[model samples]
Target: MTIRRTVKRVIDGDTFEVARKIQGTNRIRIAGLNAPDSNQKGYSEAKNRLRRLISSKQVTIVPVGRSYNRLVA
Candidate 1:
């Protein structure tokens, strides 16, 4: 399913938060890839780049499923 919402936060390089009209907010993870963690050398750059790309913008999410609670898109 495709969902349209405003990106509220970037949790990391491949994960972010989205706020929806009725559903409140949900954390989402990009599928089929991995990025450096916060303690890793490239983490800051990766996250910063991702944040610049999507911060405060409306985005579409196509969820594949859930990992714990986060939607994998």
Candidate 2:
């Protein structure tokens, strides 16, 4: 399912939440970018950039348990 909403918050460099209810959820985490814990460089910026890419827009998620296994977008 695809949901439409704006970014409500940015957490770290790999997590963010959307505004309102989106398919009954709001969190979105990109799989490709991995960091060495919270102290990793550009961790926060990476997440912020991702938030900009997806926030307040329609997104279609093809859920994958091993989301980090692939490199497609």
Candidate 3:
């Protein structure tokens, strides 16, 4: 099973950085819901929604590989 982590920051609707005291930085990108760029339409809203959805909460995280820092929710 994947380890659950507390959200540290919301990078976007599809991604957020997880805070941990490991040797390196860790970030997670949502599996689905490819949000547009910050300048794209509904970008802010989508990002906001994502933030609100997971802010200050714990979630499960399963790392796929080092090739990509993205993690599917």
Candidate 4:
């Protein structure tokens, strides 16, 4: 299913939060990509790239699976 929502926040490089109708505010991760953590090198670059890609944007989240509490999209 495709859910329409606004990007709420970027947690890191690979994870973000979205505000949706059915799920309210939830976290989602881009599958199959591992971006660096906060303490790692290239972390800023990765996060900045992701921010420039999706910040303040409306996105279509197609949920393929779930990992614990976060949805994988």
Q: Rate the local accuracy (lDDT) of all candidates.
A: 0.92, 0.55, 0.76, 0.91
Residue-wise C-alpha lDDT for candidate 3, range 1-73, written one tens digit per residue: 5887788889876888776767444678766458988889988998899899998898788765442655555
- Residue-level lDDT tens digits of model 1 in 24-60: 7899999986999999889999899999999999998
Clash pairs, model 3 backbone: none
Off by over 4 Å in 2: 1-8, 18-26, 35-37, 66-73
Q: Clashes in model 2: which pairs?
A: 6-56
Q: In every candidate, how many clashes are there? A: 0, 1, 0, 0
Preferred candidate (lDDT higher): 1 or 2: 1
What's model 2's lDDT at 1? 35
Q: List pairs with backbone clashes in candidate 1.
A: none
Better of 3 and 4 by lDDT: 4
* Candidate 2 C-alpha lDDT tens digits along 1-73: 3444565666656656556563534555656755444677776677667667766666555433333332122
User: Which residues of candidate 3, in runs, are more than 4 Å off?
Assistant: 21-25, 66-73
Q: What does the lDDT read for residue 57 in candidate 3?
A: 90
Off by over 4 Å in 4: 22-24
True-structure RMSD for candidate 1: 1.2
What TM-score fits each model?
Answer: 0.91, 0.50, 0.78, 0.88
